[model samples]
Target: MTAPSAAHKPVRKSRAVKTLGFRIAALLVISIVVVVGLATLAARLVFHKPVDPEAVAPVARQIHILITLAERDPQAAREAGADVRDEPARGRVDPKASRFLKDMLAYTGRATDATVIREPNSPVLVASVRLKEGNWLVLSALDFSPPNVWPGFVAWIVLIVAGSGAISVLAAIKVTRPLRIIEEAVESVGPNGELPHIREDVGGNEVRATARALNRLSVRLKAAIESRMRLVAAAGHDLRTPMTRMRLRAEFLPEEERGRWLSDLEELDQIADSAISLVREESVSGDAETVALAPLLESLVADIAAADLPVTLGRVEEVDVCVGPLALRRALTNLIVNAATHGGGASVTLDIIESQAVIRILDEGPGIPESLIDQIFEPFFRVDLARRKTIPGAGLGMLIAREIIERLAGTITIENRDPRGLRQTISFPIAGVADGLLSAQDVECT
Candidate 1:
């Protein structure tokens, strides 16, 4: 095999870096916002008090005006609703006014009362204390101006979280959307299909690199497919001359000899046909459609039966698959024909398993040799080369089946029945329209 060109191999890259960049950028933005919000909350709870005890106290101390005015006249103190006590004091000062003055003087002993004349509205500060006059003296002291700034602070927090969430969502879509597009484009290339081209216009550098890689792979793949097709065509053309001569010579031989020679020529023709089909199956360019796999299997069985083959189809119904209908039908026919030719008959079953349509064909003849089981999938490989003379099979059937199945994004696995024969299982994906028709008894492949 020739080494792939530079265009085919392209430069290798790790997608994790681009993915990590998007994640880190989005996370950093979100983290900063979260930190600021938390810091703001912490500062509010730690540094900003709910209600300042100092500010409230000064406001309560404005009652000092009435106390001082009541000190002047005895009748005036009583009439003005100032404290009137049942006690005597020096001078004509009202007894209640003298007591009130004494209490105010005692209350101001530890705290200040200097601004009374300079600022009457000066807020007061009062502490819990025992008063000799039986009433508490509450001093009010106030700052000329105090700041009230909390509502605006709270609004800032709400905005941060909402903004962070919105940014993260947009970032995730920016990253995931392009990746999904790449995925769909990759899926477009089946085992037989050509790879797609990478368009630089679709995304940034990372996406451009990916598209370039896909385009490179496409070129290499096209070359490989063309090579295989050429080989198949060459082989078919080369064998036709010998096959024609053998058929012509067989006409002049004894009846029994002619039968044997004719059968040999027929087998050669089958082999050539199988080679052509196998090459075609491998060089696909993703032309597939939804198909009802069960009905396809049933039809193959019916055809085999019409040809007088002893084939029994069990429960072939309602299993849909997405694939090339003609290619899948050919693959199934190859498998069924293989079983009929080698095992004399086949028991076929079709059903859905784990979102896949699975078709199984079992033969009651001696099972495949354990040693050759793996090699059986290789083109033109047979368990016993001598059996080719008697079996009338080209041995390319299973190989063709596998190639087609894989091209459809399915799989084919083989095993042996305990003491009897070979069991082959073909599984294909059910999706899109194929899945939608799952409820239908008979799905028509479009």
Candidate 2:
């Protein structure tokens, strides 16, 4: 192939950047290092002028004695020790001593200069004084050990560490707050059918971009579902007119042939009606309200029993949930009917398990083959073509039930029971209103 154009050239993707948590941790580490570094630098600058403890005590003592002697008698004090010199002593001034000792000597009416020296091998402290007689005197002391830092250095280190830790914690919370909000918003989208918009004014560029993309996806998904419902409605309505016309024409056929013709037409009409009903149920939005599930299920079982169907309600707990009552009842009715049709009879029981309201529908007829169990919930799916002749359904019941249950934030599962028959289990989150209820009692529907 020829060389690709610049526009068509494959671009190499850069590696994904670190997550927000990792970046925050890195920032914390860097901030700690910078803080510690600055604290160390400040300590160095404050304590650059060092003092020899071994020399400071003796030097201060000797300076005091020299000032006292000069005030009494200058010539006698100078002649009392050979270590004392008249001319200025060879030494550097001590910054600390200049602040305190020099003032004391000046107050005594004696002019003096004090110095502390720290060299590689020799450490010395010296003080030079001028007497009232215009003569000079000097006092000297020797030190052995090396220079040492100020005592407050350790305290400064502790303060820096504590300050860094506090700053890091605050920074982490500031950086992750927006992410937590986005996470909750994304999770609620499935149950509520709408994604809450994120505040793009906060957080980093990548986070804002992700929020915008999720919002777009949510809008598109809502539109697509609405479009599909519209199509199903239109198709169901279009098929009804032709089916009605065919049923009308079937009436003129010979009596023997008319029955079969009318039966087929009626089945077609029922299928179209069922499709429309499913679409309507899926599209309808109803306000959620607190519902007592046990009473609702008991009434449903009573109605089914009155119809002469083999159904019974077993032990049921007084559990409440927030759901659209009409939708939940319809979904439960469909599950009951399916169990009765396929498995001959259904026995339903309810209980509270691990903070969830659990409902089980057990049956006593031949169980479905394991291979076809998963396919049964698909729209228009039937386990066997032969059974379709006897069973009058468009195979949308289970699919519709599942949709309704999931929309209510519940789960439904079906499995073959031991020996023979199928079991359908449904679980829903219990509403807060159900707390502190009376003990559950066995419910009988006769």
Candidate 3:
């Protein structure tokens, strides 16, 4: 068999792993950002120092005058361009001349930030220094640049964040591995698939609870199916005795009486037989041995032809599949009968399509209406609108066939041919097999 392709199958990502990864990475990033910002501020405070005080005294005095003037008659300060300042004269400076001098001398016995200036051509700098009077001496120094303390902090933060994110992703993989396994197993646990065993129990209480629930559900489903099958078997067995007695009694009547009674009895017999067959087919499991589909198709074709149905094997190929021999045979027989009866016999063809064994039986009879396709497989349903037919049947053949095919995880479909006919297609999973020749000497049942 060929491998499943992307078109036929889809790849799904693990939700648990993805969620965990994002959460861990985000937390680490936030932590790094906050810590890095605080550390940068701390480093700046630790390394900061004061510049020379002498050169700053005159500048400080000029700034103090400008503040005093601005606070009183603000327009006077603006008109005088009072914010401008220059270097002091080389001499023993008079501390009393500077208004801010007294405040500086009382603290470090010095002066600083001696001026404030508004120069249209130059950039401005603002500085603040503590004084003895519990006040501050403020000034603007334009010629110099402040310290750069942010680079080290930002670099460390980037390093920490990147490292944390990488570590978190790896850790999330380890943490969510168990949940991923459980998810995959849960996904596989359906009517057509088997659940796999979950290994590595990591996700706390929630994971354990989910696992427990799944186990309980599995057990409940098994019991329910078993109970249903048992009921069907018992019902089928009970119906056989009465039906057989009726058939025997109908045969003992007079010729005139027997004719009408026999027809009714025969129909009832067919109904009972179909019911029993349906129950048996539905109850069978998929533990049967594999069969070579080529010979099986050929044999079925021959048997159908022997029944005077114009059935012929068009093209047969060898494809082995996992199926119960009896059940598979019955399913094919039902399809053939359905085709022959309603579709006026058919040319059966079998071939493999994309790893699936497909059987197509084409007939020339009037095809079924599109609306009735779904109803055809239902038991007791008849496509014959007039309800006048020589062959008496309970309409359980297709139902039984459907059940048998489903038990083996196969499918059957019917479609209309171009020139007014029907085509029945049955597809089953193909197992590995080797091709062999068709010998004429082999048994042909027809």
Candidate 4:
């Protein structure tokens, strides 16, 4: 494939990545996670109170006195509020609290063996110490159940956050459901170029409002388009009757006068035909078929050259594009003829660019004024009166060319070439070989 000309540039596809529903879903999920995490941290900080050393001082002194008495006399230790036990206490204990008790004993210069435990279904701490008589003395200590309660809360917090994530995903999906519906509805638009009626009475307020607006807009647009097409068609048919009668009358006039009258009538007829064709092209389209583009361009160039126009075929690469054969051929013919007849000469080249089949028609005549460039596609928008006088056209060629190209999901862009002349580039998404693209040998230049 030949390289794209400087005038031809590919633009980024913004719509492909910036989907409304996907963005909304991501925003919702991220918000929910942040909120859940922050809430959990706040709850943890609010309920987890710090220990007061003054309140624990009395309890620490009493336990120390009992442990000392139990080491000297076991009987006196029981009377001093200690629960005498022959064997080690049953059930598991908090090793952290036991170590704390040992540290307290060592601080008072009396190293003693100790174990602290909080049994299941119990709300109190039990501290046991080994006496000198080789028996055990157990005493009730202040509650140490906060440690146990907070650990289970950690698990609950985890479970809550996990469940919340799943719930958030579902909620996000629900939140963006209307957008998905709208997308599908647009994609499923009928061949009549009208949006299908959607439910406006159901769903959330926003969804219902959107649906109602779309339905109303579709109705108004379809009506407007149909009215315009009908008006153009009627006008085109009505003019032919008068023009035909005028042609008969002109036949009886002098040779010189008759030629002038006939030429004017023919031009008027051409204008009417162009207008009707534009209207029909706007309202309707046929099934698209994959056809080779190189052969098509070559054929168009050959036919126009044979007709004594300054048209030439340049380097063309084999590529297939999906489009209606006859409509595309007509549009191409109009564009090539415009370039050749107005731009002095036409050189057509077909190339493949980033999976798109690109056709560029280069001409060498004086290019359009920069300020008037945008209006070139307007119906009957001829350039200057001088160009109009020389060119035999209804000035609907470029307008019709753009309409037919866009209808087939292709693009047409025009820019003035450096120094002089205009270049028109047409591109359509490449349709890889499906049904065969007709080889040049099989297509006769018509």
Candidate 5:
């Protein structure tokens, strides 16, 4: 078999254990153990009161006298309360008491394998020593017992656990810092669809890298948008010269054909105007304030009805939204005109649902085809080709309306109404909320 080539060799992935998060997690766990150990050591040093060697010095002297007395007079030593035993000693051992007694006994020329054990049943210390004749000399006393230090040990444990918890929380926050930054940046998007500026120099390596990437994307998007607007505006300006010349030439056509020629020229003029209007909606930004929906809806209906067009105001709620008043009015006017022109008549209504101020415009005209519904927002998209000359639109109304609404930080959705009409809905984030109770306003169909 041929040796595997370097290109064919599986790439070695960096181990998860080597990641920053894993290291932080490992350090956090390791820190808990270290803290516990330190707390235990601190407790021992601060709270544990060991038996002082001096405190048991008398016990040592008593054991030495008992051993000497036992060597000569076993009965007198018994009278001195020295318990004599032939078996090995029992109970727990006291190292401090044992060490003190050993040094004292060795000084008096009585060095022996001795131990001091406390009785299992009482608060007592017992000193044990083996005599030269193989007998065990034992003495018990109450003065050598030590104080309880368990309470101090418990306190240290509590402090260690609390400190470990705090460290864990800090590690979690640090790990999620990038995510928090992303969420905050998205939430702070302004009414003009402008993203909040991100600082690249701050934060950890991962966070700084994310911020840099987002800032680059934002810069690229702004450049693309500006380029598109410039191209549209320049194209619109170039078309006006030709359109003016066409209009002048159409004025000289034969009397029978002059009307039709002028009508086509007028349609061309409207298209240029619509294109420029779309560009304005994309590039213009400033002077945003809360505009109420009720008065705006009423005024639009009145104007359209006065023009002898089929338009009506339906239930309008007194609600406000943050947006540029003129920009908002222009967007709504386009939608209302589109609905009234395409759908025989338009009925507009405004209501507040949840924290959103919703506007619904219903028209009785034949709705758009289901197959072409998604393309309705595309610029210059027309579903009914036969009506292109019959209707007076450049097919830019829906696109412009959508652009304006979205730039104002709102949403629009169009769906076919069940029986025979189209429903266009626009939603905006309500500002300076009114009580949930909608205002009572009766409006008749025009």
Candidate 6:
């Protein structure tokens, strides 16, 4: 198979990259992760101190009262479950608990450092502080269990994450909305020669810049295409005057020479007329209307049959499509004439398949070569080398037909039929509610 044009090749490769929506979502997810990570880091910095004053306050107050009692009366302090010992307790001191106990002693105006330990197999916290009499007073209280902050911390974290995610999604939507509009506008451009412009003031700087660029490009492209069509039309019209003068001058020649020159002039005239017609077909700007496929095909076949052409209509279905009636008829006529002149005879069929209207034109002549099938759609491309002594043509029939079909958001393809001939299939999307439906009275041929 032949490679696609450079324009289409880029599009195929572009599919490998991430789409705008996915990219935006990824960016938002990463942003949320980073933001949440930073928030967690800040929380750790502010709350990670080993000694918390509020957590150790109640335990410290009780220890201070017991110490006061021991300093006043040692026997009464012992009866009150406070023990004055000469040596430190045989237990491992928790550094965090010890730091908290030191802060507690300082807050209670005691000028001594205390050793805090967790008794084995007990929830009691013990602390040893030196008394004024040079004895270590062992103070004990139920362990100060700080309130569990994990559940509340987790709840706050969840809330923050969810809120951030929602905001990120909104931000992504805000960023991508204009891009989506631009994409729709670009895709809406068709062979109909209409280029829609997008709003440049609706998005961010980059999006607005892109919209402006696209608008300028659309305007330039439309102007260029129109200029080309005008040049073709003018060129075709200018040739007619010369051809007429040549025909007039040929009348003065010898009879034999006159016939030969006129025949050649007539062929030239036909080519010029075909070129003009092709240009006009391409420039067709009719609004799309609901047309019945069955009646249109029947009318075309009738016209061909009136010309004594071997054209048959078969399997006509009542399918409706939104298209320019005049352009569609002209395009179909070109295909039918091509089939009859080159393929010898033509058979037209219409059917509704998978919500699409399929129009097939089959002919009983030698089919085109597989290698040159795509080339035939190019303007003025001819398969004369393969056909040998085929009828003369300006080679714009298939090109005009394809342009018309594509303008109607349809596709036309040619394939070789088994045994002999070519099968040209044209498929159009079925008219939806937006295109509107046609009543019986509105089903006339153009």
lDDT of 5 by residue, 64-151 (tens): 7778888888888888777788854787788876776676677656688778787777766677788978888876645444455678
For this target, which candidate reaches the highest lDDT against the unseen true structure? 4
Candidate 6 on 294-327: residue-level lDDT in tens?
9888888999999998999988889898777888
The list of candidate 6 runs beyond 4 A from truth reads 1-19, 38-157, 197-211, 248-264, 287-291, 306-308, 320-325, 364-366, 369-371, 386-389, 407-410, 416-421, 429-446
Error of 2 at 3 (Å): 58
Per-residue CA lDDT of candidate 4, range 1-446, in tens? 12122112222333533365456556666676677767767987898886554556567777777767877787787776678788668778888888877766666556778889878888777888777777877887775334555676668657765776677667766776666656645654543466666777788887888888888988997898799889999999899999999999999999989988998898899899999999888776655677899888888889999999999898899998877888999999999999999899999999988878899999998899999999989988877776555567888988889888877667899999999999999988787531232211111111
* Displacement of the residue 196 alpha carbon in candidate 5, Å: 2.3
Candidate number that wins on TM-score, 2 or 6: 6
lDDT of 1 by residue, 1-446 (tens): 12123223323244754576578567857786879978987886699654434444433344444444444553685576554443321122223323333344445432322222112343332122222443332332233332445677668866876777677766665666556545545545545556545565767666677777767877988798788789887898789998898888889999979987888789889989878767666654234666777667777898999998889988766866667778778888888888887887899998877777788899988888888789888878887788977766777888888887775667899988888998998887675634332211112234
Better of 4 and 6 by TM-score: 6
For all candidates in order, the CA lDDT equals 0.64, 0.69, 0.63, 0.76, 0.75, 0.75
Model 2 CA lDDT for position 83: 42
State TM-scores per candidate: 0.52, 0.58, 0.56, 0.63, 0.57, 0.64
Model 6 score (lDDT): 0.75
User: In candidate 2, what are the lDDT values of residues 1-446, reduced to their tens digit?
Assistant: 12123222222222221256556756786677677768777867787765434435555556667667876876686577634445656556556644445554555444465544333354555545554454555655444333454455567556766776677766766677556555655444543255545556666776687667767877887788778888988998999888878888888888999998887877777777778878876665455677899999999999888887789999999988866788889899889988887779999999999889999999998888999888878888876788777977777888888877876667899999899999999988788633322111101111
TM-score of 2: 0.58
Please give the distance, in angstroms, between residue 60's alpha carbon in candidate 3 and its true position after superposition: 12
How close to the true structure is residue 5 of candidate 1, measured as C-alpha lDDT?
A: 30
Candidate maximizing TM-score: 6
TM-score for predicted model 6 compared with the true structure? 0.64
Which RMSD values do the candidates have, in order?
A: 12.0, 14.9, 12.0, 10.0, 14.4, 9.8
Output the lDDT of residue 409, model 6.
63
Report the number of backbone clashes for model 6.
0
